[model samples]
Target: MPILSKETKAAILGAIHLKTESVDVPEWGDGVTILVSEMSGLARDAFYAKKEGGKVPISQSQADLLLATVVDETGALVLDESDVASLQAQGTAVLDRVVAVAVRLNGMQPAAVEDAVKNSAAAPSGDSGSSSASTSASQ
Candidate 1:
């Protein structure tokens, strides 16, 4: 195959390629459904950065992933960093249900999330600066 031109490559990279799914959360209310979208490469990177070496808590990690993946009809994120506390206050089962879908949609194994939750319980709590370093490097 002939090599693609720069413009073609740019167009491909700029396209909206993430997949989305509707999640049912009966616990929240009767027939309550939410939309979740697959994470973009940058979003996924930021997610892993926060959980790098399991420094962050499991609840925090789940909230961060939810904030990144949960979207509106237009694929824009519905939650922001300010909503982390509120998201954490939500039911664990509900969070896990949605987070599981986001993880699978983003190509992450369920086992990894389980391990992170387990490891985070024993992991220390503090800014190790690893995530900051990653963010800096990416920038």
Candidate 2:
């Protein structure tokens, strides 16, 4: 294969390459459906960042993923940050089903999400004393 020029590489990187699928949700209502799309690299990175230091709650992580991947027919996001609480309030069965699709489309394993939740739950909330103790011990 010929080596791609800088312009060609730029064009390839700038193109829309994510995939979208329609997810059926009988639980929501008869004939209810939603458009789920693969998260872009940047979006995926940001999603993971939310889990960093275990600051984000498990429900918020799920809501964040939903907001990032659930889009409309025009490929625009259907939900925004303002809708996070509403999304979290949704039935867990339907929400998990949709989130599973988003996770698969984004090439993330279910274990990753489970692990994030576990880590977050185990993390100390606003407890800096542990760190200070470790620092003093080392010194």
TM-score of each: 0.69, 0.68
lDDT of each: 0.84, 0.82
Q: Which candidate number maximizes lDDT?
A: 1
Clashing pairs in 1: none
For residues 47-106, could you state the per-residue lDDT of candidate 1 as single tens digits? 788777747778898999999999999999999999999989999999999998998888
Clashes of each: 0, 0
TM-score: model 1 vs. ground truth: 0.69
Span of ten consecutive residues with least summed lDDT in model 2 = 130-139
Query: In model 1, which range of ten residues has the least summed lDDT?
Result: 130-139
